[model samples]
Target chain A: MDSIMRVTVYIKIKPEVLDPQGTAIARALSDLGFAGINKVRQGKIIEIDLDKTNAIKAVSDTESMCERLLANTIIEDYSISIGE
Target chain B: MDSIMRVTVYIKIKPEVLDPQGTAIARALSDLGFAGINKVRQGKIIEIDLDKTNAIKAVSDTESMCERLLANTIIEDYSISIGE
Candidate 1:
């Protein structure tokens, strides 16, 4: 039986990129009377369950997934974490 | 002058809720020839910069924001963290 591992990948837009969703969120907060909000940036978190035992291989595989599909490397940066 | 604080809010679908995005991600990973993937769940992260000195007030304000707009509490759950 393969050991199960949980992986978390966080993908965020590059600082130089403009995030419209973040802008909308900030405006909404202001409209709601929540003041003192300077800025807002939105990103995503993808959690995956993998049938693998080796921690090193799990991280490498997840990173590849992020590079290929999970994240748009051109405009976003992604980090991965693996857990038992 | 109000001090600056950074807040991160993570929103995820409730376990009982059907996650089509997650399903799509899983299928995509499989199509990419990466096997042994059991499940995938997708979520969002919103990073906010606040001009506030009091950490407690900042958290409360952020929580209110989450309840009002940041998250759809009926089908999603959200967690928040504040940092300097």
Candidate 2:
């Protein structure tokens, strides 16, 4: 088929991992006087366009990429989505 | 009615604003020997837990938060989703 495929990966710190950035944002919101903010978690979104045709291959490829460079598996978790 | 609402905010760089970080990511992916990576863009996902029950109020509050601090609207654009 050889149609260009689009992938989106979301990477976030594991719940067990402390996210200073998220904490900072929560604090900043509190400072700004915005009430009712119980928690804030920050994550990264990576959108990629691949010159591949197969959706399954694209998902596998994206997962490998996340394991290798996109995410730190020890403290971060990543999920890959294809064609969206 | 006071129920916890989860709000998700996605902030992305304005298309006109050059994304050096995204460029670096693409370059890194290329160096890692993954082929067919044509374009890459990086964005931020902020998950917020608010003690608000009204969906409309939560959305409006989130939009204001993005305008005030969560996003740099000058060079970035943000989208907010509630109860998801």
TM-scores for candidates 1 onward, in order: 0.95, 0.94
Query: DockQ of each candidate's interface versus the true one?
Result: 0.93, 0.90
Tens-digit per-residue lDDT, A1-84, candidate 2: 646788999999998999899999999999999999998999999989899768888888899999999999999999888876
The global Cα lDDT (0 to 1) of model 1 is 0.92
lDDT of 1 at B48: 96
TM-score of chain A of each: 0.93, 0.93
Binned by DockQ into CAPRI classes (incorrect, acceptable, medium, high), candidate 2 is high
Candidate 2 chain A TM-score vs. reference chain A: 0.93
- Superposed model 1: Cα runs more than 4 Å off: none
Report the Cα lDDT for residue B3, model 2: 73
Residues forming the 10-long window of minimal summed lDDT in candidate 2 chain B? B1-10
lDDT of 1 by residue, B1-84 (tens): 546799999999998999999999999999999989999999999999999658888889989999999999999999999872
Instruction: Indicate the residue-level lDDT of B55 in model 1.
Output: 80
> Which pairs clash (backbone N, Cα, C closer than 3 Å) in model 2?
none
**Could you give candidate 1's per-residue lDDT for residues A16-68 as a string of tens digits?**
99999999999999999999999999999999999866889889999999999
